[model samples]
Target: MTALTTPREASDRGGPVADIGPLPARRGRRQHRLAPLIFISAAVVLFILFFLWPGALGLLYSFTDYRGVGDLNFIGTENYRELVGDDDFYRALGRTFLYTALAVPAHYVVSLAVAVLLTSKTAKGKSIARVVFFLPWLLSPIVTGVVWRWLFGENFGFVNHVITQLGGSSVAWQTDGTLGLLVVVIAGTWASTAFNMLLFIAAIRNIPRSYLEAAEIDGASPAQRFFKIQLPLLAPTSFLVILLTTIGAMKEFAMIQALNGGGPGTENMLMVQYIYRTGFERADIGYASAVSMVLMLILVVVALIQMRFDRKSALS
Candidate 1:
């Protein structure tokens, strides 16, 4: 057996006293503290590099007449002043808002409906149904656009072929601005519904079964149980879903680009598309940056307003 000595005895021997309890505990505590920081450092570095750095550069460029190549001349808000008076900018912004307004509610309703269906106790083949529902979301936006374009292509396309076979004329899905916008809205909703459905499913599952059982025992119909208990309880998740959907809709680009290229003469051009055209096509980087900054501000304002409304709803 190894020799054991008291602290006093060890110190008297001119040897360091054993720290049986505190040393290991302190080291463990330090490891615990450091692990979180080490884990988060990579994310922090990425956020700084990708988001903050680019955002700073964009903001700086917004105040300067920096064409993609030439010397930067500080225009001191001239880009912003011109943006304020630009008809195209306003139209794009309005279209973006319209898209968001249409998309968010559709996403909510369809996703919620799917979630409710999948979570029903009597539902069968849920796994297969979930996979099928989620497949659209797994597709690349470009692929989704291509698939939708094929389906709704104006002529020599599947839908038109079916229509012509059935004695109806081919619809102007690609060429008509309103019809094209409607197609995009439908495609966006289909692509996005799965993720929001998952969120609602998780939220619904977390709710106590007892409450639902009690509501059922009290002779509540399916709709009554949902509206009286489930819907009220879902407010937080609903808010989150709506907020995320709104932000995503506002920033949408790839799907729209692939689907219609903001076509029919910029009739459906969104704010991001407008920015892209200004910066890349027109070589007006300064104006594009200004528009980006304004769009960012608008998103911030919208988010804040939504948060305020959510808070008030919760409090009341």
Candidate 2:
């Protein structure tokens, strides 16, 4: 019962026919165009305010004599010059490197092993096990540090109590510099390993089971299957884990604060801890900024190197 109208008549009548085609779609798109911007506006603002602005300001202040106070003077790399010659800074730098070197490998090895075990076909109650393992990661760093500190305390602590009960002499864990650093490393490893394990588990689970089955059918041993099949495929995830753990170890400060307070004469001082002390305690904002810039540079270079390796691995 409907009559066909010409396009010119439809246009003149302003009917629904005139409004059909791309016009509404274009209008709808234009209306929705602001929706995404609206949703992301908050994140964009926060990124600029918290990350970009602060980082830019810190970099700018590194070259100036801004002691977190009124007067500021551009010292022209004087802070960096002092940073280069500062023996304490170098000592902390070395300690940070040592921590990263030891902690990253230990964490990775343990996490990978745990991930493999958890993902195996014979594994039972993996959900419960995963939760139990990841519980430490749910706790705050300060809480973990404090609990471990107490456990490793000199007298009447759980570890020492057990040791003494076993006829071993009670050890002064937090007093000695080397022992204190060791405790920090161990605590850091325990706290962080679970998260890394989860990553590894995901990566392992993503690998096709058919590959392993074929290898096993060919009379390959478990070790051979792991090395030739799983390990090679896990290179990308391994690279990610290493880079993250290394950066984390380098920036460790809170755990040290809660555990030993960088005691035994700065023997366990991390780069971030040193930066915090310099800026907040020593009130040397400029020098602290310069140190932060150095740390940033180190992290950037490490990330770039990892990226290069990852790209090469992928290509191969």
Candidate 3:
């Protein structure tokens, strides 16, 4: 027990002390890293199981002829090739694109313009206006769709009734191919725009009144102050909301399907509706999976582009 080793012996021996004591080597610190590691590991595992695993399997299935009946077989790009010539695919894609394009900017502009109006002046109608505006978004989409479907129906629609009351013929509000699509877009926009408007109102309210006061003191008009100051700060949120709305509009099957049943030669058929028809009605799950994968790719590209624009707008 009294034996003392020289420094040379200790160095030469390279024994347990260096690995276990004194510095306690690299391995011991690894145990200290376990808590964070455990958290990260669990997250990764859940991510793989819930989202990534399913997505990967779906992507693989996209290339095969599974048909939801038998074992999946690898066909090697045949589904994609067929998808290239698929007319319904293109038509649905076009409708979805148009819906997102027209509906998004229209809602943002109309709603923001209304919010701007409401935010100004000491008016008695403000609270009631806010509630009325927000009430549509509060209802379930199915309920909203059902009510609006009757309100836009070709035979008994309220809008056509109004036109008739004004001495006009009952218009084909949801019968003509293009007009039916427009009705869906308008109704969809009406149901959702109020939600966006409330957000703008909240954002506008949170901004300091001192800035507006300062602007007003300098003879800056309401428009000038809003454009020069408040809007710039709200740009990030607005961009994000638009992104969400655009994506939602792209996948809007329920409203379109419920309203017109993708009527008039399936002109109102959205991408999701097409996929649904292919899968269930046509009972071609393989082809449907292929179509879905294509839709996913399109959405991903669109989202990336919007994010890039938002980022650039923020930086600028």
Candidate 4:
């Protein structure tokens, strides 16, 4: 027996068939993938417009006689040529490096020691000590410099008063070239120690207790355990702290301004202060821009070197 569909029924089933191929579906899929990018595109545009565009313009203006206003003229490396012979700028540059070299190590060592003490079982009032130590870090660098300036005051300061009470002559801490720079370093070290201490503290606590217990069971002395175990583990954290502290030290300006205003005839002048005084006070905008570009290059080179060193150290 055979059952057959009629022609009307076959036409009814096939009447609405139409082909829409993979191209249209692929177009729909592409839009689905691009939807998230729409939300993030505004931030990307803003960064390029504000940061990248301004930076590029600054680099261009460095080579021209753009006096922060008025007509601009193409000077063709004249600003850079003048910078090569600027003795004051060179001196400020040297002082900045010297301060960084001194302050970074001093801060690192002292902060590590304090962090060890605070995290030790024998230490008392750990929370209170941490709070007191970190309070100075919370203060603005300008405020720290101002307060230290008062403390370094010749006669009326508490430090001078104490010296007088002890029958010692009052000392001028900021007039001598060497002493002035040393005071600046001391103030910077004090201001930054707490933050580094906190970093070291957290790093030390993260070390596995099992390693220490194992070392002790093997009859290792505390010093032996620390040097052989803890120091090796902390190398990464040490690298990070050094890198950050070095950069911060290099850009020091607020403290220098509030402390001595780059006084004593540029004894305490730093790179940033030099740039500021040149661009604003002297109205040498072109030269200032050139100097700033040089600084940016120096920082970039140093940072690259540091990163390479850190990577090798960590691998070893």
Best by lDDT: 1
For candidate 3, write residues 198-314 as lDDT tens digits: 888888898898998999999999779989999987887698778888888888877777777788778888889999999889878778888888888888998999999987877
Worst 10 residues of 2 by lDDT: 15-24
lDDT of each: 0.94, 0.90, 0.83, 0.87
- Each prediction's TM-score against the native? 0.93, 0.90, 0.81, 0.85
Compose the digit string of candidate 1's lDDT tens values, residues 1-316. Answer: 9998999999999999877666788899999999999999999999999999999999999999998997999989899889879999999999999999999999999999999999999999999999999999999999988888888888766988999999999899988999999999999999999999999999999999999999899999999999999999999999999999999999999999988899878999999999999999999899899999999999999999999999999999
Off by over 4 Å in 4: 1-51
Candidate 2: regions farther than 4 A off: 1-22
Candidate 3 — which pairs collide?
none
Poorest stretch of ten by lDDT in candidate 1: 17-26
Q: lDDT by residue for model 4 over 117-206, one digit each (tens)?
A: 998888999999999899999999899989988888675667888999999988877667787888888889889999999999999999
**Cα-based lDDT at residue 40, candidate 4:** 86
Ranking by TM-score: 1, 2, 4, 3
Which is the winner by lDDT between candidate 3 and candidate 4?
4
Query: What lDDT is reached at residue 144 by model 4?
Result: 92
Sort the candidates on lDDT, descending order.
1, 2, 4, 3
TM-score comparison, 1 vs 3, better candidate: 1
**Winner of 1 and 2 under TM-score:** 1
